[model samples]
Every structure is written in C-alpha cells, then in structure tokens.
Target: MYVQIDLDGPAGTLRVSGHGLPTVELLRSPGAAPDPLVPLGTRDPARLTLTVDGAPARIRPAKGRLSRRSYRVDAIVSGTRYRLVPCSYGESRLTRDGRPLGTLESTGDGRVDADWAPGATPLDQALGTALAAAFGTGAQPWWQTAADLAAELIP
Candidate 1:
C-alpha cells in the first residue's frame, strides 16, 4: 500500500503524493496538487512540490554513507540542512547543528510513532511522524507512506 501526505511551509503549501495515494491519513491532512513547473526527476518513489522554493532537493543517507540498521536521512529545508540521525536505542533523531529536536520510532505493532523533544513545535512532530512513517509497512497504510513526504519536511 501507499500514502500521500501534505505539509504547510513558510512559503506556501507543499504537497506529497503519487504511487498514487492512500498511505497517509486523509484524517490528518488533505493534499494539494503538485506544480508542473519544477521537475523532481525520477529517482524518488514519492513526489512533492513547494509553491515557491528552491530547485528540487534530494534525499540521501546521512553523511552520504549507508547504515547497517536503517538509512538515516538528511536533507536541506529552505536551504538549512537537517539530519535525521539514528539514536543508539533504535529510533531516528532529527537534529540541527547538533541540537536534539525530535525522535521518530517504529512500534512493533506496525505503527510509527513520533515524539517531540522539549521545546519542539507542531511542525517538528508532524515531520517526525511523517519521517517515521516513511519506513513503516503493513496491511494498512495509516502509518506507512513514501519517502517523498519525509523529504518535503525540510524547511
């Protein structure tokens, strides 16, 4: 199964879809259409677009290296780079400039969980949850979505 997710940014609304839909919860957010002007190329399994932003960004392993556990994600948001590094305990950590911001984890029951560090914002939690769900899989698509959604959270 697949899911589609949408997020709001400082510039304008960003939409993530394709594969074509049903992974993310429509209960959480309704998606917007992607702009045809900017091309995302063909490497990603998911799709995203921001109303007025830089050229398309790429999702790569943190530090440009592979991991034995899972791929820790890294990307630039609004030109600011952010890393979703893995914690020693098996969850992924989203940190900027070495400051802890949030944690995203996979529950054994097929649900992905997101927990914001103290002083985190709603967007942080939402992004973390979306990141967590990017790695999730199951019969239901509620918590399992595409990496494209995770990439758009940058900025």
Candidate 2:
C-alpha cells in the first residue's frame, strides 16, 4: 500500500493520508532534552504524538549517538515497536523488531512517499508514515550544517 505524508499542514502538524488508511494528524513538539552525557551532534531529539482511532502513540529519538549522517527514531503502536532509520539521502526505512516494515522517501517538495510491505496493518501504515514525517526527510537546517562543517574543520 502507498501513503503520502503532507508536511505543509498547519504549523507543528503533519497529515498522513492515503487509500486503505484513515487520515491521521501528528502533533509535533520539542518534548524533552536529551541526556547531556549522550553525544547527539546537531540533532534535536524532538518528540511527536498522534492519535489514530482513539489510540495514542508517541515517537521520540532512541537513546544513542545521533550525528548528521545517521539517526534512529522509534514509535510504539499497539504494543509493536516501529523504528525509523534515516540515511543522509532523503530516504528512510521503517522497521519492526528489526524486520523491514516499509520504506519512506522524501520527494524534496514538502511531501514524503511511503511504500508499505504487503503484511503491514493499518496502524502500522499510519504510525510508520507519521514517524518518518515527524523525523523529517530533508537536508539539515543551514545553521546545523554550518556548525557541523565548522566542527569538522576545527579538528
């Protein structure tokens, strides 16, 4: 199944909609601060929450080192763990318990395309797509890019 995530919704909102799935609205928030001891370079572990059919789920940065080139975000829906691992490109893979659930690709036009596996459930479709949209699928902010460049040059 295919779904499209619209990032151009009202500020701090992401809309996920497509065939075979109900429209879901994810609310974005800068939840809590990352652990000071953990090394997250130029990456903000923002939090996202969404409710689908009265079931609420939360997505947040997993505990680990998040750098400019790689990062991991996680969401739990109906007791199933979904992880989104994004690469440098405008692409990300959605995994469930280490198994591939789907793929999300950014079109660089304020939208993301999500292709789901054959066995994915409706909740899986909604949550996975929302996670990818909330995590973002584009180049880093200019300030962050510049800071990373400066850090590399200083060493």
Candidate 3:
C-alpha cells in the first residue's frame, strides 16, 4: 500500500491518504511534549497530543537525537506499536517489533510518501502515515538544531 502524508496544512494538522487505508486527519493539540528538549527561553517542552480520526493518540521521541544520525519516535494506536525511525536526509522507516513495515520519504517540502509492505493492516497504514507526517523530515526546532551544532563543535 502507498500512503501520502501532507503536513503543510494549517498548523498542527496532518492529512493522510492511501489506497487501502481510510483517509485520516490528525490534529495536534498545543503544549503537548513530544521532544525532550524545550525551546530556548521556554519554561517547558512542548507536548504533542494527536487526535487521529477523532480519537486521542500519543506520540513521543523514544530514542536517539533528532538532529543526529539516528532518531526514532513511537506511536501506539489501536493496541499496536508503530515506530518511526528517521534515516539520513528526509527519509524514515516504519517498523513493528523489529520487522520492517514501510518506508517514508519526505519531498524536502512538507509532503511524505509512505510505501507499506504487503500484509500490513489498516491500523498500520493510518498510524504509520501519522508518524511519518509528524517526524519524517530532517527539520527540527531551531533551538534543537543549534544545540546539536554546538555539541558537534565542542566535542
């Protein structure tokens, strides 16, 4: 199955479309923390709460640095775990229990293309598309980008 995720909509909105998967729209609530680091001069990190098809869902940074080579975010929906692992550039891999599920590639804009493996369920398509829309890019918050650069220079 092939899914397309558009993140360029209004702020905090994600639109997902695919052949076998039902179109899903996810909304992000303000002040939900998905990253460990808070923006500079901010008191708290921004929290991320996504509403998937009118149901609340949670996604958070699970491992690695967002600005580094390896970074991953985990989202659980419908009792299934969908892992979005970012690779070089604007590409990401979605996995479940160490099994390859799909590949998400960003177009350097805000569009992402997701190609899922055969036998993937609807839940996988929806949640994987959501995860890719949320974190499939190489972009990061300005503060986080600066911090990463500083770390590299100082190390």
Candidate 4:
C-alpha cells in the first residue's frame, strides 16, 4: 500500500509506502513509535519494490535503525515533487495547485475523520475521501483479492 501526496508551496513530494504485505493494523497505526521491521503476512520481510516517476526506490526496514520503523525512502524526485512532501496534515491545507483543501486521518477504529479548518483546500478534502474509500472502515482484506494485487501495481 502507498500514497503519493503532492502538495503546493515550498513543501516537497511526500509518499507513504508499505514495503511488505500491508495490514489494516499497520497502516492505521499512528506510528507513534517505531517497531522492528516484520515481514507483512509472513515471518520474514516481503520483497517489494516501488518505481515512482520512472525511478525505483527500495523500501525496507532499517538495519540498525530499527528504533525508527519508518523505512528510509530515497528522495530522487525533484522540482514540484519536492514541494509537496511536507504539507501539514490538518484542515485548511493547500494543494500543489494552490487549491483549498482539508486533511484527513484514518482512525485505528476503522473510521475516517476529517478536520476542516479555515482556508482548507479541496486537495485535503479529496485525500480524506480517498482514504475512506481506499482503506475503508475495517479490515476488508482486499489485498488478498486478485483485483487488489493489480490495483497495487504489482507487476
């Protein structure tokens, strides 16, 4: 599972990708703490790859950086791509095109919450709506489906 977030302003391109077999629990976690890299749906790390904008970036657990569960993804993107990576996730955020938007967060409880602060933009609102549609309200277990695999862009 992954998300390509394009933000406007000085922020850069930001992407959230799940290297191994992604689970509802893993994705929904606020990631308040870093945990050891565990292979998704297996006892070992699942071999995976992501090619963004024609460049391949490997995603894996940090060796000695286990304290930080977040994988270190290479930032090979440039230009506007770099400007959308740090938009604050909240209401009233602007899109890369400078549109009014709102930010949405997925609650571990299977509910999608959206905060609409002042100056919110459409991109933010679209993200919230997209999350609810993509992740849904519970463990839909769609990843196991054939359609899900293709949708994930797994060649």
TM-score against native, each model? 0.44, 0.64, 0.63, 0.23
lDDT of 4 at 134: 26
The C-alpha stretches of model 3 lying farther than 4 A from their native spots are 1-6, 18-20, 31-46, 62-70, 138-155
Off by over 4 Å in 2: 1-4, 29-47, 62-70, 138-155
Model 1 lDDT tens row, 36-132: 3112111122433222123444344322122322445555444655566556444777775567887666532234556667876443444444444
Write the number of the candidate with greater TM-score, choosing between 1 and 3.
Answer: 3
How would you encode candidate 3's per-residue C-alpha lDDT over 30-146 as one tens digit per residue?
A: 544333231111112134555566676656654444454345677666666667776545567778776888787754345567777987777777777666655554445446778
lDDT of each: 0.41, 0.61, 0.59, 0.28
Please estimate how well model 3 matches the true structure, expressed as its whole-model Cα lDDT.
0.59
Error of 3 at 128 (Å): 1.9
Ranking by lDDT: 2, 3, 1, 4
Instruction: Write candidate 2's Cα lDDT for 34-80 as tens digits.
Output: 33322221134344466665577655665433353345777666677
The weakest ten consecutive residues by lDDT in model 2 span: 34-43
Q: Looking at candidate 4, what is the lDDT of residue 118?
A: 71
Q: Across residues 76-148, which tens digit of lDDT does each residue of candidate 4 receive?
A: 1222111111132221122333443444444222233554657543333333333332222222222334466
Q: After superposing candidate 1, which stretches have Cα over 4 Å from the reference? A: 1-58, 62-70, 107-110, 136-155
| Top candidate by lDDT | 2
